[model samples]
Target chain A: MEESNWEPKVIGFLCHWCSYAGADLSGSARLEYPHNIRIIRIPCSGRVDPMFILRALQNGVDGVLVSGCHPGDCHYQSGNFHARRKFAVINRLLKYVGIEPERVQFSWVAASEGPKMAQVIGEFVEGVRKVGPNRLFKDEKKDGE
Target chain B: MENRLKEEAGKLLKEGKVDYIVGYGKGTVNLRTSPLITNKEEDLEGLVINPFIANNLSRYPVELKGRVGIVVKGCDSRSLTSLMQDKKVKREDLIIFGVPCEGVVDLKKLAGQIGAEIDRVTDAEKEGENLTLQVDGSKKTIPFRDVIFDKCYGCEHPTPLEYDMLLGSEVAPNLDIEKSLERIKELEGMDAQERWNYWKEQFSKCIRCYGCRNVCPACFCERCFVDVNMPQWVATYATWQDNLTFQLIRTLHVAGRCSDCGECERACPVGIPLRSLQRKMVEEVKDLFGHEVGIDKDAPPVFSHYEATDPDEFMK
Candidate 1:
């Protein structure tokens, strides 16, 4: 297959105990995945404030993926659970305001699910490509002044 | 109603129950009311209630230091509840004088009807359904419905929902839930790109005055995210991106907390239809979490506490 000229810029906010470890394991296991995502490790998914996702979009990132531990599996016992509820409201609000629903994605990736993390990244990049570059709230300041 | 309000306010001050009364007094400009804080019994004469009393006096109790007797209409009373929930003001510190509101006039709408700048409104009175306004030397009497603020048309509580003392008889709510949701429904019917363009046009007009934020009773944060400089949560520029960020973040911050008092919309100088954004969140909170803000002070904020069975259909 010919490589596409477009490469979507994806920002992944990964919980340290779960999704971050999962991404690291994917690296150690040499599982190939799209290089589109730039990972930001956070203490817990609950720490991923909706502002961060919105800021990333405003800064012209093509997509945002927030991954945390599955329910009942959070290291802090309830962080991911709390994050799940917040993401639900944020996602709905974004969609209601005319943002592409696919621009912001949420999922659960346990520490051991290295291949799963790779799959999530690949799919998110593809989905964002289908929607094209995000112009919603994009900063209009010219690059490098 | 005005005489009763003044008498009750005087009684509260004369009895030394409150250090001051937060009510509306005559503004420097005619036909305008300003938030007045007074402790003198004689000053109660300045306290007035009219269709022009658009100021929400709820935030005064939180900002002022001392026992305050605040005059609250239905919407103002709800805002007081939100303040109490946030611990910004204590119930004991406030002597709430509840007034049954018959809707306040929208100054802009009235100005538009008159067709010229109102240099001064010599006199104004609401008699039954007609608003008699003495503009300059000519008197214009318009139907009250034609000049009343849009927020009042769908008021669910025309009288204070909760108050220590009732100043007047309870008024029946002119509750039109559909009317409140009409704008939201219209926006929802638009395609995504159309909606985006619509908001972009609106946000582009923002001057970043922060009038909406300042007027909100729920926006009691000591350091708003927009003002933070260390990590700059949102840029201070007047660009559309920054304006959109400020609005979206502020809405999220007040989700399940905003009382839908319409103060933000009323305070906006550019007429951004802020209530539309806020009401959308209000409806979403009600639909998803089954909670309405500023109703029960005992209940925790919707986002602060989550039920085990809270809907998570949007989650993976």
Candidate 2:
């Protein structure tokens, strides 16, 4: 895999009240994970529109992770539940299109799960590395390479 | 055709009752007549009714300014009825010239049938029952039932269910309804996991163009869920899961209000069978409330009126 010469670019969308705080705890605890991930904080995981995921793929992101509160622990009470249903539907669609489902990940992360957050990110980064960069929609007709 | 409708339109336009008249006119494009909007009397000469016209002109009334006179066919009038049902347009807003349409032809299907490309076409003659179509180069006569849209084939009513001015002789309503509901029945009968898998396969290919919503007459919300920013329903990704969420939510919102116009299915560039999904909801509405949209202008929308005896099949 080292000789494959592929670096994965992962985009993480973490809900503000849960996953984002868990991520902050991971940094505070000095936990180490792959540094290839770029995090975008959102109000709630439910706020992540499906278009955001497609746009990232179109812009050449290798993998996308959407982390929110656990099923029953969403700050807004039922936001995570809605997000779960949405992710299930979107995940099934990607599988149908022959896109490796591993490229998209959904996880439940509460504010206290610092070590778990680091572990999740590390596992996602490793999985993405094995899968390699997503060149599925990358522009091949660049005027100057 | 109704002489009263022409007289009313002519009187309204002559009296400056409307800024323009929007109706079906001669096809300038290949084998397809479009919704023609006119401010001049000369343009009204092109108006003819036999039933090759197939456009929902309801959207123009919402967008265009000033008073407008519109010709409403059976399905086209349904669009108007839906708009009125939703309070989107008022009866006094414009003059309506209703045409009793047997059914409109599906131009896309007709184009495939005839090898020769059609530059322009119209339903020129109706000899007893058969409709004669004059295309760019040649004239082909086809049985009215054979060439019209499938939705129209099973049409329970040939006259505009609601219209201000009746233009043509009203044809007896053809009550063959379930022919269109067959596919919906097949899908609804499938087990949950099977249905899920089937839909997963279908929604995965969707590009999320919003064409289905845009073309639907019932979906008149100024700001759709796709544009909502407060708590976005789905991500802006083309991924299968996101597309599923978008469609499921949108479909649920339009459950009872949809008239099964088939515009969503036609507008789909990738040719997804959206009508099947829509038909399922239509069945549910009928089963629950015995309510069919656009059929009766007096009945309140299903969602707007709650029933104490509503089914709780999906409720936990």
Candidate 3:
């Protein structure tokens, strides 16, 4: 519960073609963002199932970030569009069930949008920081151990 | 209505029309009806059109092969249309007899209202908005709304829209939307953390029986995600954490397909109000996707297709 030692752990599912390249671009351009997120490269945003987000939360991750190509810019053609529809429902369901809106986030970052990627991560990490640590979905029996 | 249904069922069996006639027959227990699956004309004599015909016969025909004649109420027909969209069952193979349902009684609510066990009721007759009952030797009357399931208060179609034959005339939809969605409104009224704690306690009582999954018509997957050990999408134990995860995944899986049949809530042994979560999602799907579950036979499944102009305010 000490303020200095608490850091939010975020899991980012980055699409292979766009968001992953954008992350690489941000690093190449010498932009500094919060190092809170651990990135997982996925084939496309459509491949990110709602189960993945729930599983991440269950594993005690403080937040989940699903980054894909913009609405019309998916490499596989409409994969991001499909992802949008799925995330809309999942996002609403999670909020209705009482999960904080800051815990799970989605965004668009193209390969050229290195500054946008840096900015998005900075904002997301700050939001997760405000929400603090994720103790909600963890297995309670294992806490004392 | 009872005699007409029996006569029609017998005529079909005599004509060698269907391999099975799926309907409800009088159960051995008082005030309970069991599903009747038979090919004989004699079994047609057991058919009863009581308010207690609770089982949704739509899912029963899924495992049965060959031509089938099944009885369906308003909500059940919507479930049948959903199955048809999924290509799970051929519409031509099914000869559906639609029953214009007033509503089915919730025996627990009935017992609670009477301040006695429901088994004491020897006769129940529905006359308009009043329900006449004979409990032991005394006669008591009550309003139908007092003893009906909450889902019935939100019934959109009392008569089946998709049926091969109509057993009765069309009945108008009598909706008490606020009454049906009372539990949902209560959840919505809570702060986020309180809502989470409420569900946490509710799912904690789950015994991992998988009764809700088995009874859902939309959950016809050849293999469920929880069954996979390679990845172990969910732990195969009774921890409240895993149970909550399992239910969350299950609810998302059935978002646009579930017709709010209320079978899952009835099947739950621990008395979890599973319908609260499901019914909430049903309204969410309609608001976001502009799609109502199983209402249109020609429409595609919600998740399988996407619109270019879908809501994306949730995304950054």
TM-score of chain A of each: 0.91, 0.92, 0.95
Instruction: State which candidate, 2 or 3, has the greater lDDT.
Output: 3
Q: Which window of 10 residues has the lowest lDDT sum in candidate 1 chain B? A: B307-316
The full ranking of all candidates by TM-score, starting with the best, is: 3, 1, 2
Candidate 2's C-alpha runs over 4 A off are A1-145, B2-7, B115-126, B133-140, B296-298, B313-316
Q: What is candidate 1's lDDT per residue for B1-316, written digit by digit as tens?
A: 7798888888888888899899999988788889989888888889888878899889888778899999899988988887888889998998888889989888888889888665566888889989898887898888988787777877888899879889779989876677667888899999888888888889999999999999888889988989999889877879887898789889888887787888899989898999989988877888888887778877776767666777766665
Q: Report the lDDT tens digits of candidate 2 across residue range A1-145.
A: 3436667889999999998999999999999878889999999988986667766775678899889987668788777666664565455444433456668888888899999999999998888888776755433455123
Predicted candidate 2: what Cα RMSD to the true structure? 8.5
Docking class of 3: high
Q: Write down the C-alpha DockQ for each prediction.
A: 0.62, 0.04, 0.88
lDDT of 2 by residue, B95-158 (tens): 7777887777776666666554445554356666676767764687776565666677556667
On a 0 to 1 DockQ scale, where is model 2?
Answer: 0.04
Ranking by DockQ: 3, 1, 2
Candidate 1 TM-score, true structure as reference: 0.93
What would the per-residue lDDT of candidate 3 be over residues B1-316, giving only the tens digit for each residue?
8898899888888898888999999988788898999998988999988898888889877889988999999999999999988888888889999999988998889899888887898888888888999988799999998888899999998888799998888989999999999999999999999999998999999999999999898888879998999999898988888899899999999999988889999889999999998898889999999999878888898988999899998899
lDDT of 3: 0.90
